[model samples]
Target: MDKDISEITDKWKNMNQTHIDTDEKIGPYLDKYFMKYKKTIYDSALSLFYALDTRNLRKSHKHEPISIQALKCFKDFVDRNQATIEEAFLEQKVILPACQFAIYRESETWISTICKYYHVESLPKADRIRLLQKTVNEKKFSSAAWFAIYAKVIREFNLQDIYVPLICQTRISVVEQLMKQDPAIAQDVVACMDKYIDNAGELASFARDIPGANFCLLNDKGIAKFAKRLAREYKVPIQICPRIDYNAKMNAIKFLFRRRYEQRKPMDKRTWETMIDSVFDLDSPASEDNNLVLELIYDLTNYQQYEEARRLAHLHRIPENKWPKLLLSNRSSPDRPLSRLGSGKIISDRNPKLVSVEPEKYSVDLPDDKIFYINSHEKFKEMNSYITKHPLLAIDTEWKPKLGLLNECNPKAALVQIACQDRIFVVDAVELCRDSEWATFVNAIINNPNLIKLGFSIHNDLRAISELIADMNIETKPESFIDYAQFHKSLVQAFKIPLPDYPASSGGLSKLAYTVLGKYLVKDDQYTNWAMRPLTTDKIIYAATDAYVLLEIHEKLESWCQERAINYEVLMKALLKKDSTKNKVNIK
Candidate 1:
């Protein structure tokens, strides 16, 4: 029998060498040989050897997609031989050695098959003793080999009945050697055991026996669930220490686990308790553990379980001083002030360094019949003159709402409208430039210190204008203006005012107008050629209304602030600070 086995092994080895060296199709040859010696150890070993050879060769180019035909053939062979393989193990024939080689070669597939056939009753005590002895003798197998065998055993037999003792004994014998050679593999094995096993006492005994096994594999959700389970099982409180680095990943896993388990119906609670207790027994708390705590608090806050979050915070002894900053949630509003310091009353006593200025004055003299284009240099001059006359101008711009390309170049800036008391002048930049009388108006508005600019998101217009006229100086002062969108947002939050659903960052002038004024302004010519020589009446009206609405919105928001005694300087400062972060704009 030994001589015959040696001859078969040599033939198989030569065949493998030939397959490696030549490009001949080897699948048919393997199938023919495997079928010819169906029940023998020779057949089993040859089948496993061929399958592993094929798989390894393919794995060398692992990224390439696997051939479906080859996979199907391999899977079919495993399925057909599964019962025979298990029977061979039970009979302790020459097939046992072949089974060991099969496990090492196609570890994943063989383990999966074994797991499916695992039945304690089917395995007679004599066979079990023989298999155990084989496992002990082959204990020098690689970690990958052990992992494969362990996985199969766990899957095949009831873990409570068979796997626990076997794994414990295996670890006792090989853990020290495994740890010495590859500490990470040892740690991963311990973690896997901690996660799946259900006996805390057994796990603790194992860990105590194996020194430096300090890490637990429980994720955040696992930790929470495990902590709760331990409290119920042991009738004692278990403090869960957050391992922050791993918490997020663990939380994701726990969520998936809960979802899967719930779908599967009632699980064993005792099993769950054991698993949780075993995993968490390795935890130790640290000061940097606030992120996980914060995440938990945030989740609780989402569910409006504020009291529970607060209690957890207190019990954890988290610093109370940082609570306000950590716990506070920012709500979005359409016209919410972008500045953090740009809301509330101008307290003269507290913030004396902050400056307050009235809106710049400007006069409008364009005839109603004449049309003006927004981007015209001449129109800018006339508007500048009007602003100079009044020294306080309500500056605003008009552009296509959704057209990105048009807004990028020669953007129409119509209705350089000036408001003084009840009078509003729409200084048409295009029409005024045709007469060359707009330059003085433009100069006056540009040069005036007392002419404070007022608009919503005026920084954009300022930038646009700066690009249009190379030397134009728009007052970039943080306190020299009022951004109505930003002011309104702060007002909404501070006064608990109801706001529409929109991103906190989205506070376009048009949206603000629609929300605050209940009237929709037209922008028919917004996407029209702004640089076109002829301007339409509809376009002029659209441009004019853009600025006109700003003057109105500004007055209403200002009055609203005054009525509430809100400090405008503080609000502006907050907004200015926020804006500063955005563009690195110098506010001085």
Candidate 2:
């Protein structure tokens, strides 16, 4: 181990030295450290190199004592030791910051060295341009060097036509950095980009690749021109990546702001008129019968144009039926045909049905009062009265735990839905905190051991809820509870129940509910903004059903356990003693 550590340290020192080092020599060091102390040493070295490089850059700038002769000497040293530098950079021996510095300071040299070292005689023109642009803009390389590289690639590869596409996809910071260093090169690249790639979609994709390409600022005239060009170049119904599309739209908006800021002029009358027309054109009219309005709302919402989104949503009454389909459609591709059809009809492979079961309907009567939206004392009193009357509460939470700020670490729970025998209460936890009475009422339900709190995998929900209320000085009892998962697993094992053919491990409480109770629960609103005001009917229904289905599932599982003479107490005890330690084995 000592020998291994010494060898690793020596290799690192050689790599970081002023002169270049050989990969053959450094290889053993990298292998030893990466193999021995993979995460710790590697990460620490990378971080240290980054900080040192930044410090060096700042120091070099401050102490301009180094003459042109010294600079040339340093350049000569780099050139002479090019092989070692190239090896170190390629092997990632220099760490990220130093590597970035090398890319910025000596991109052409690095690229040439890398190509030669790898025996890659030629690279795709677009890739070459991308690399050059990334190095120039991202690493703050000189404009002269950037243009020199750009010109050489274009001339050597005969890539004049593709230059615009490359430029369009190049980062704006690179452009700005190049312009700051040398405006002539920046102007040339901009001109090249403007000359080619006339289509909006292509332009959008290009802008998407570029760090700061804005698509939203393309005025009516610009869009009309691009749209016309796109029609000529590509087929109708163009497919685009949603993330890229979103970025392009954002960029366009930024472009508008930039135009206003730089040009110091208001939008022209024609442009203003076109903006209104374009927005309206994007909206669905009664005659079209399409959810164009909804699309517009989605676009506006995504762009954070809250007022415009709300206005369009209201104007269209954005039918709830269309929203889910539209949202899913935007995210995923239309299904492809399966080899065999259940009905025995040989379906075409081009367009297959993306089948998802329609959510099941429930007949439980809920109060007309919008308890989810309003944080009122009266609403809390009414909800508390309802819960007390039917104290046997079935609780569930609908939250995108993975989507929260903390994500894997500390996830926030929202929309704590509780169902009694008949009524279902979709409580907005976000709003509930605002009302002191609502908080008090929720605390009562959480603390009451006599309530018989039932849920499938209620442990997670309990943990999350406890963490949330911990700030309020409310201590929740972790002991008194029932877990449906443990109970169901026990019954399945005891009876040797036939498992379904689907992926065994993937199915959780929802699948268990479907298998046991023969009911489908809606999970659509599970990821929705449960904290949003004016909770929709769909959200309410989805939330309520989650808790309600758990109640039914628990009852069914319990009865099945009893019938099979499964030890319910043992199962409960096993669940209670279940190891919280992630890597530890559960002895129970």
Best candidate, lDDT: 2
Q: What C-alpha lDDT, on a 0 to 100 scale, does residue 340 get in candidate 2?
A: 21
Summing lDDT over every window of 10 consecutive residues in candidate 1, give the lowest-scoring window.
Answer: 400-409
Q: Write candidate 1's Cα lDDT for 396-510 as tens digits.
A: 6543221211012334443355554334555554443343443344445533445555676766665544444433443333334556656666567666544434323223665
Off by over 4 Å in 1: 1-386, 389-392, 399-420, 427-443, 446-449, 471-479, 499-507, 523-525, 567-588
lDDT of candidate 1? 0.42
State how far residue 38 of model 1 sits from its true place (Å).
Answer: 82
The CA lDDT at 132 in model 1 is 40
Largest TM-score belongs to which candidate? 2
- For candidate 1, the C-alpha RMSD (Å) to the true structure equals 25.6
lDDT for each residue of candidate 2 in 1-588, tens digit (9 for 90 to 100): 445545544444554453334334444444444335423432333443334344332222223211222223334434554544433223333232333433554444443333333223234456545555565455243432443343344333322223333334343444343334333444444334333333456656555555444566333346444333332222222122222222233344444323322232333323322333332324423232244455555654443444444444555566556554444344433212222212332322212233244324332345544324335668767788768666467877765333111002344566677777666777677766545654555556765645656677777787667655657766665434556656566556656755443222225666676567654443433434454556667667777767777767766666766776766555545554553212121322
Give the range of the ten consecutive residues with the poorest summed lDDT in model 2: 400-409
